[model samples]
Every structure is written in structure tokens, then in C-alpha cells.
Target: MKKGLIRTMLSAVLGLACAFAFAGEVQVAVAANFTAPVQAIAADFEKDTGNKVVASYGATGQFYAQIKNGAPFEVFLAADDTTPAKLETEGMTVPGSRFTYATGALALWSAKDGYVDANGDVLKKNGFTHLAIANPKAAPYGLAATQALDKLGLTQAVSSKIVEGQNISQAQQFVATGNAELGFVALSQIYRNGKITSGSAWIVPASLHEPIKQDAVILQKGKDNPVAKQFTDYLKGPKAAAVIKSFGYQL
Candidate 1:
């Protein structure tokens, strides 16, 4: 019995050792708006699969520039589907590895309660001196914010008081830190579980702007990295879907 027990123990230890030895890492560039939920998911991914996810967060447009310049990113989780589709057309992505991983929602948010009405009437009121928005030239959410403003005929009225952040995360930080009285941000940033988790927000209606369809793709550099493919597959599975939905993303 003692010898049998020793043999089983040795086999288990060897199995674990082999798992660690072969475990690989994937370097991912994630959209800034997805920072919170991705971080949470990555932790679970690491624990469950024994593979490592090294993530960098920023505007999707900026990540595109870096990828084109040969940044060593294995996977990309972009803020919009167009950017990933563009990369595929350019032959920079692994064919048949592209998919829409999430669809995001935008919101007008403020650090103070009652600052933004549910109907988003605060923009017309124009009570605040400064309003924060991401750089429309580089962030998809920023472009959506402008589109919403145009639909409401408030672009011209609020243009003078606008402050730009290089990315969505920074735009949200401006509002969070009182640098701007209010800002347009991803609903996931301030909401969860059918409620707003922070100050105040008005979830922008989809009719006000284009759908924020976010996509994921494995870049050419990652085509040979098995872990990259694993990570993307993981994103499609139920566990990752739960995290995405919890963060207010429409799968």
C-alpha cells in the first residue's frame, strides 16, 4: 500500500511539473473601456488554465498603430469591429480567427449625484463649465459621443467647453478626479448588475449613435503562439461571457 501511494504521489507531482513547464503566455492589447472586466477575467483565466495573460490597455486606434509598427502583441481586443476588420484586410491578422467578442454601451457620467438626468438633458442645460470626451480621432467611443451630440443638436452648443483625453480611460479619470464636471464614458465603467455603481449616469441610447461592436483577433505575430488561440477561444466560452456581460457588454 505504501509503495502504491508513493507511485501515485509521484505521478501527480510530475503531471503538475509538466503543466507548468509547457504553460505559455499571451501578450494582449485590450481596449481601455474594457480594463476592469478584462482584468477580472484574466485572473480567472490564469487560475483555471495555468497560462499567463499579459495585457496592455489603451485606445484601440493607438494599439493599431503600434501593431502596424511591429509591437509584439499576440492578441487584440479592440473597441470597435472596424479596426480588427481593417487589420484582417491588410493581412496582419490570422485569417478565420476574428470575431466580435463584445458590444459596448456609452454613457454620460458625472462624479456628483443628480448631475446627469436619466434622459441626458444635462447637455442641453449646459450647466457645467467643462465636459470631458476621449479624442474622437483615436477612440471609437469618442466618435460615438460626438455622433450622439450631433443627433441631439448639442455639438455646437457644447464644443467650446470640451476637454479631450487621449483615451477613454483617461477621459473617465478626468471626470472621476473633478478635472471635468462630467464626461462621456463606457457604461461598464460606472455600472453593473442592473444599476449604476457610481455617481450618476445616463446610458446613451443605441439610436443616438452607431453600435459599439468590439472585436478580437489574433495578430500574425501570434499565429504560432498556441496560448494566443487559447485565450481567444476562452473569450468565447461561458466563463468569459459571464464576465463580459457583468460589465454591461452585450456579447
Candidate 2:
């Protein structure tokens, strides 16, 4: 009777151990501008699959530095394609795992009504006293904003009133809290909860800037993790695509 009871306990322990080993979580390094859509998509992904996602959001430049210094991120959702491509070439990311996840749009926004023109003509008139923009060297959205200024011939004229943010999120906050009269920000922020918010915004035309093709890739640290692949596949599906689009991102 004693031997039989010991066998039963051992079997139960082994069974629990196996279950724990099979349950996996994938760690994702996300860009700041993608915060809302990615969070929504991650929730849907967790529902569809048992796997869980742990995401960290920051500037692409910061993520790039961390990845290069051997950060343990399983996947990188970059604000632009360049960093992921570089990582793949450097053998830090899994080959053939890179793809464009979303296309971001740059917008001039103000929390107040009528601060932005429907056609974006306010840019030419220098209508606002202060305009916030991200750091062009670090954030893709900032680069796009700079490009828009150049395209509209407003770069030199508007340089003085420009206040710089380290990332797109900060740029949005500057405008949202009235720190700056208006600012360049990600279009995603304007469309929260599946609806456009109170702020008036003008989506910068694609013709005025280079396409912000956001990309993602599985990193070397998570190359063999089943959860990483599962999460990546989930982001490409219809449900996740719908969530991404609702945030003003183009899939």
C-alpha cells in the first residue's frame, strides 16, 4: 500500500512539471508609437492561443541598442524596417522571420478644436506659436515630420517654434496637455477606442514623406520558442489586422 501511494504522488509531480515546461511566454520589444494597437492585438492573441506576450515599448534607437548589446527580447516590433533588417544581417534575429507589420502615419494634432485645418493648410500659415516634434535621429515619426516640413517648404520658417520630444508619445503628450499649441504625433493616438478623439489632426500625405513601414522579427534568443512563432503568426491574422487598422495603422 505504501509503495503504490508513492508511485501515484511521483506521477502527479511529473505531470505538473511537464505542463509547466510546455507553457511559454514570448517577450516583445515594441516601438512607442505602436503601443495601443499592439496591446489590443496581444490581448486577442492571448485569447486565441494559450501563449502569453510580455511587451516593452521604447524608441527604435533604444531597442536597437539593447538588442545589439544582447537584450533578451524574443521579438522586435520596430518603428521602421531598417533596425530589424540590420539585426537579421548581424545574426541577432532569425532569418526569414522579418516582415512589415504596419505602416505608420505622421500627423499634426491639437487637443483643442479648429487648431488644425482639415487639409493641413495651417502648416503653411505658421498658425501655431509652438509645435512639438520627436527627435528625427531617434524616432521614425520625427523623421517623417521633418520630411513633411521639407516637402511643404516650412522647415526653415518653422524651425524656431519647434520643440523636440525624445519619442512620438512625448510629442503627443506635449500637444495633449497644452504644453505646445500643436505637435506632430502618431495617427494611432487620435483614434483610440475605435473612434477618433476630440483632437483635430491632419494625416501627413505619403507623398510628403518616406513610408513608415514598421517591421517585426523573432530574435535569436527566441528562435526555438514555440510561443514566439505563435505570437508572430497571430499578429498576421485577420483579427489582429483589424485591431491594427482601427488604430490608424495600415497593415
Candidate 3:
């Protein structure tokens, strides 16, 4: 009886050790525009899977350059599909690992009440002195903002008044802090529960620019890491989708 009991305890210790060996932490590079949703999703992922997620948020373009220089991120969630596709072609990411996770929307927003009109006519009226947008070179939202401006024939008219942010979050901060009067930002930043939570905003029409199809992929460094693949899968699962949609992104 004593021998059998000792064997049972030994087996339990071995099983626990194996479980610990299989569980791991993943380093994820996430786009700035996905800040809110990714935070919530990461928390949920940790709770559900007993795995740790270390996230770094920044412009997708910046992340792209860093990844090329051998950044240690195991997973990358980009603000645009193009970067992931480029990485795949460049052999920087695992082939067949890329997938569109969300479709982001752009918005024209102001901190002051009634500063923006429903039809976005405020741009034509030139009511605001400064307009903030992300840097087109680094942020997909910035590119969309420029495309919308070009489509509206306001690129030249408002070019001088434009203030550039390094990322969508910073662009939103410019408006939120009243630094630029109004700015283009990701809808996710200022929206929740099917309503604009603070200030005024105009959701940019999809016709104004190319679709902001945000994509995620496992980097080559993570191709063999099970936890990295699990985290990527979590982003596509129903629970994460709910959190994403709550932030105003389309799945």
C-alpha cells in the first residue's frame, strides 16, 4: 500500500512538470489602433489558457521594420493586411499563417461638442484650424485619412493645416487633448457599444478609401511555438471576436 501511494505521487509530479513545460509565453507585436481590444483579449487569453502574452503596441510599419531587423516578437497583428503579406513574401513569417482578423474604420472626431457635423461637411467649411492624422508612411489609418481627403478634393486645401501623429492612438490624443481641434482616428478609439462615447465623430465612408483589413500572422520565430499559434487562434475565436466588435471593428 505504501509503495503504490508513492508511485501515484511520483506520477502526479511528472504530469505537472510536463504541463509546465508545455505552457509558454508569447511576445506579440500589436498595432496601436488595436489597443483596447487587444488588451481585453490578451487578458482573456491568459485566463483561459494559462499562457502569458507580452504585447508591444506601435505603428504597423514600425513593427514591420523591426521584425525585418530580427525583433523577437512571435506574433504580429498589423493595422493593414499589406504588411503581413509583404512579410510572407519576404520569408519573414510562416507561410499560410497570415489571416485578416479585423476590418477597421476611420473617423473624423473632435473633443468639443458640435464641432463636427453629421455629413462631415466641417472639412469643407474649414471650421477647424488644425486637423490631425497619423503619418501616412507609418499608419494605415493615416493612409485612409489621406485617401478620404483626396476623394473629397480637400487634400490641397487642408494640406497645410494637417498635423501628423506617429500612430492612430496619437492622432486621437491630438483631438482628445484639443491640440489639433479635430483629427482622423480609428473608430475603435472613440467608439463603444454602438455609440460614440465621447465628443463628436463622423465615421468615414468605406467608399472614401481602401478597406482597412487588419491582419495577423505567426512570425518565423514563432512557427514552431505552440503558444504563439494558440494565441493567433484565440484572436479568431468567438470570444475575441465579441471583444473586437465591441470596440467597433468588423470581423
Candidate 4:
């Protein structure tokens, strides 16, 4: 029985070796907010499939522009599905390759303790002089923040109090450096190392705004790439899902 078990294990190892021998490299363009989780997933995927994954993280709009201009990206993981679906419609993405992987949540956070209330009623208090948000025209987090404010009836009232950043990372930097007292940031930014650290935050309820459903797709550039297809499949697997959930994002 022990000999049979050893033979089975060796056969499995050989099968894995053969799989790796046929795998190549994949280049991915991922959204900034999903960076941490995607990096973790990439490592696991490479180990499992013996394929190297090169990933770049940036705003969805920026990536969309890049892809339209013929960026050499094999896969796209967007913060919003609109861009991916648009790519599909434009014949830039492989039809049927698009899938929703996660939903993003917005949070109001401050680097200073007690600067933000748990319920986020502080926004109505007018105690803060500046509130940071990403550029609503370009970033999904910014759009969500704008929607939240509108839902709370604070959009017009707080317009003068707002500081706009180019992207979610910039908005986070604005709050971190005290350029803004409180900022709307992606939940992944504040909740790092397996927990929330910096300051208080109120996770905006999903009902308060439009759903930020993140989508992933194989780009036209990688249409025939074996490595890209393998990575895309690995991303849809359980290990990647766990890594995504660990980053304080809903998968």
C-alpha cells in the first residue's frame, strides 16, 4: 500500500512538471485597488502553473486608454465592468472572457484618531475643513463617493469642502499627508495587514450608491497566449478568491 501511494504521488509530481514546461508568461493590467490581492494571486498562479505573470496596476480609465492605444497587456482586471464590456464591444477583449470577480466598497477614513466617526455623521458636522475624494470622472471610488454624498444630501453642501485627487491612491495620500483631514478611499487601503489600522472608518453601505462590480477579462493582445488563459483560469479559482477576501474586499 505504501509503495502504491508513493507511485501515485510521483506521478502527480511528473504531471505538474509537464504542465509547467508548457506554460509561458502573461502580462496583466489590474486596477490599483485590487493590487495587493492580485499580486498574491499571481504568485500562487505561477507556482501552480509554472507561468510568469507581469502585472501593472492603475486607474481603470487610464488602462482603458492604454488598451485602446494598443498596450501590450494580456489581461485586464478593472474596478468597473463598463470598461471591460466596452472593450468587448469594441473587439478589444475576448468575448465570453469577461467575469465579475469582486465588488468594491468605499470608506471614509482619517489618519488622525477620532477624526472620523463610526457612522460617518462627521461629514454633516462640518468639523472638517477639507474632504478628499478621487477625480469622479476617472475613478470608480470617486464615483462611489460622489454617489454616497448625493444620497446623503451632502453633494452640493460639501462641494466647497472637497479636495479631489487623481486616483484612489492619491486620495489616500492626501489624507495620509494631512492635505485633507478625511478622505474617501477604497476599503483595501485602510484595512491592511489583515486588519484596519490607521484610523476610524465607516464602510459606505452598498445600498447608498451604485455597485462597484470589478471585472476581469483576457485582452485581445493575449488572444492566443496559453499563459494568459491559464492565469485567467487560476484567477477564477479558490486560492485567488481567498487572497482577495483577505485584502478586506468582497469577493
Candidate 4 lDDT over residue span 1-251, tens digit each:
99999999999999988987787898999888887778788888878778898998888898899999989998999989898999999999888999998988899999998878879999998788899998888788899999999999999889999998877888899999999999999998888656777878888888888999999999989999988888888888898888877777787
**Candidate 2 per-residue C-alpha lDDT over 51-137 given as tens digits, one digit per residue, 9 for 90 to 100:** 678999888988899888889999999999998998898999888999998998888888988879888888788867899998888
Clashing pairs in 3: none
Per-prediction TM-score: 0.97, 0.89, 0.92, 0.89
Candidate 3 root-mean-square deviation in Å: 3.3
After superposing candidate 4 on the true structure, give the runs of residues whose Cα lies further than 4 Å from its correct spot: 1-23, 192-194
Local distance difference test, each candidate? 0.95, 0.88, 0.94, 0.88
Which of 2 and 4 is ahead in lDDT? 2
Evaluated at residue 209, the lDDT of candidate 2 is: 95
Worst 10 residues of 1 by lDDT: 190-199
C-alpha RMSD by candidate, in order: 1.1, 4.7, 3.3, 3.3
Residue 122 deviation, candidate 3, in Å? 0.9
Which numbered prediction scores highest in lDDT against the true structure? 1
List clashing residue pairs in candidate 2: none
Q: Which candidate is the best by TM-score?
A: 1
